[model samples]
Target: MSATTTYNGNDTFHGWAASAKGAPLVLQEMTLKQWTEDDVEIKISHCGMCGSDDHYLCESWGPSTYPCVVGHEIVGTVTRVGKNVKYVKVGDRAGVGAQSGACQRCENCLTGNPNTCSDLKGFILTYGSRWPCGTPSYGGYADKWRGDQHFVFKVPDNMTNEIAATFFCAGITTYAPLKRTDVKAHSVVGVMGIGGLGHYGVLWAKAMGAKVIGMSHSDKKRDVALELGCDDYIVTSDKEDRKRYFKKMTHILCTGTSPDFQWEPYFDLLKVNGHFINVSLPKWDFPPFHTYDILKNQVFIHGSAIGSPNEIREMLKFAAEKNVRPWIQKYSMKDVNKAMENFRAGKPRFRFVLEN
Candidate 1:
């Protein structure tokens, strides 16, 4: 390991960071950890805003270690690659997701599940986390990012940076859960919450040959869901709509979260033994339910983390081949505060991407 790091001393990387919890990000200079042969440096071109980013900014997921620079759906050009790096090289366009590093020796990591690495420090997040060298891990809301190359991926030439950025987080989050299930032409897949993650779930499920149904509490996203390839749309708040789709889905991918979220009706929407896979990370714990419902329905209720490195690579390839592009609203990286404001207001039609 070299004592020489990429952004050192006077050669600091600049980013918009939150000085305190819930504070708007301000431009600031930051340093990188000690450089290793497995690291790669990226000059960021685009980054997608995620709900998880907000959770960190507001400290809803617990008190965030500030000054936090959070934007995990990252895409950029590789500016430098350490000697041991091989997945990508300098000048190649690359992208990173919520994960930056994990202990390679962990059972989960060795089994190709680094996204859920078992070691205490193995699940190194791109932001709101710390590196082994005691440096606070910053994310892609910056001019550059330097970290373990294993978590970084080369962008497909068929996709633009803005489009590629969304897949790293929102895309992978939904895709991984759905891929775990056997969704095919005969399957009826329900995508709950037609927002950032749900939109991708709809897209991926449809591409996987399933009859996709877009579900939301209200009808606001109905037309957009149809445009995103959903075969049908259901407003779950409507009793008639709920009755109409009773026991209809082979699996339900819950991608949205609200403090007042209702879960019982969605459980009824699932077929016997259907999967109710939730990938949303809400600040509030789910309201309690009766075990009778679970026993009677014989359904599976589980949660999924972000995808492993191999899963991410597989998703990117599948997305590119299927032309699975996200509906993104772009903002200049300098207007990050404005973007955050809009995000808080739920303004993104699907996803928001920041350009450098």
Candidate 2:
């Protein structure tokens, strides 16, 4: 028999899954992907809930298959691994994030940017996608998970699973762009919207020694933002105050997502050659922006997806070394439905993690 058949018996686990579009997730038995030589199976310990979870379940992004298991931020212990896997061993603390597998032969992959793998069919996402061998892919809202070893990472020795889960997606997402853009102590960084990813941006920016500014619609979050280490707070509702800081920031990272967010005023916040990165997935298309303003300020505006493996490793070490931890609430895996309700209501002090 082939290697795939040899591993057939231990090929299933259980996780909560969406039984229908926009319906509550229910417990379901999930099958494992084909046990390739590079696969790693993990006993999931903690998984952070993201707005992306709600988007997928509601078919907000696109049409999703029924019973799709959706989660990305995952931290766990290695339960098993294929012989080809070298980085993680059984009983090691590890993690799997928004992505799972990629085609190593692609140009981006060959250049150490596998997160941009060109072979769409070979890019195996952790959820709402398929494995290379055609088995359905599930996620971390469960007792266990299975996927290629390439996407699995080792958690830092001092990091707890709850904090580690955020690094998998939200932490890496903010860190990659900030590091790439050269954010430093001299840089004045503004974080827009104090949500899951935004909360991390503030802490990471502060940890990096940048002058951190919190920008929100009002002062409702000002006190909490300060408690989270924000050095300054900008009330966007105050037009004169907004005008005073024109062209003052070195970088502005936006993690808020709303159809009504005023995009025009933010362009004025960037200094020459400043970068504003969008890490949120809002449903509405932004209103037209002024080309003249972009040209004059030499500011770069673009959206960032979940981060890369190299960046993930760097972020974990940075967070671990700096003792950077985002505020997070824990929920038992069995109480996931109530957590989901709270998640949808935007009730998290910062983020939520499902503990198994």
Candidate 3:
């Protein structure tokens, strides 16, 4: 295989950026670097707008680098691949998620936990971070992107590119915890929140043969949940009705970050020895409960980050096998600012994907 030469042109690509603190995202033109031997250049086809993207671009989480291009849930075609890249070939459809690179030789990497690699200092996030060579790591909001082969995954031939874009982040975020839990065939599983991550949780749990229940604040989504294969729908705001459904769930997955949420209601919903898993990044006080609740029921609470690459691959395979698909709205790449605004406003029907 011949090595690919460097690309050196003033290729104009449109991407949205937050050039300063507390400012709205603005569309900008950037010069893309030439492709290297270890690089795969993708002409981004679709990029999912995640909550994290909004958090980063608006500097909500913390101070962010200026000129940061922040979309991470990326699906695109490998327009060019470096000679050393064997995992992806030119023209192959691929996706990139929250992560872009890690130290592959660390203990964490060798053990399929590269996401937790300790020696890598700061993890190379897909956007607003410096690459190993010191160039900024841009994301998939633009017309194209160049990155190492390790961070990219080939989109299964059977999956639509729009859905594949979501699998890059939302799909894997929920799939990781579900795979690690005790919920299985005939188990009662409750998914709180009907947005991106919560929807995937309901779908995957149902596909895994669990009796899945969709829990939300409004009854309007009840029909949508059932249509998405949920066996039951619980409106959490109806106190008496919600109580009636409590104590039936063997497992509860909380995808919302309501710090003021009455935690006792959710705990009451769990059966003896039930487990509650949290995947949402919410600011909340710890639940105030007695030791009796823990001892009598053996209930447990836990949290999970996004999955490892191996886990992501398995989740994609599972999604393909189960015919799981996310409800998404597509926006043109040029309208990235509008997409970010909509995501911040929670305007997508479910998830938003930016298509080039």
lDDT of 2 by residue, 10-123 (tens): 778888988888788888887878787788889999999987888788787778987788889988999888889998999999999889988899998889888878899878
Q: Identify the superior model by lDDT, candidate 2 or candidate 3.
A: 2
What overall lDDT goes with each candidate model?
0.88, 0.85, 0.80
**TM-score per candidate, chains pooled:** 0.96, 0.96, 0.90
Which model is ahead, 1 or 3, in terms of TM-score?
1
Q: Please report the TM-score between candidate 3 and the true structure.
A: 0.90
Scanning candidate 3 in windows of ten residues, the lowest lDDT window is 1-10
Q: What C-alpha lDDT, on a 0 to 100 scale, does residue 257 get in candidate 3?
A: 47
User: For candidate 2, which ten residues in a row score worst on lDDT?
Assistant: 1-10
Report lDDT (Cα) of residue 295, candidate 2: 87
Instruction: List RMSD in Å for every model shown.
Output: 1.7, 1.6, 2.7
> By lDDT, who's the top model here?
1
Tens digits of per-residue lDDT for model 3 on 251-288? 88888745567767887888888888988875335567
Backbone clash numbers for all candidates listed: 0, 0, 2
Per-residue lDDT value at 75 in model 1 = 95
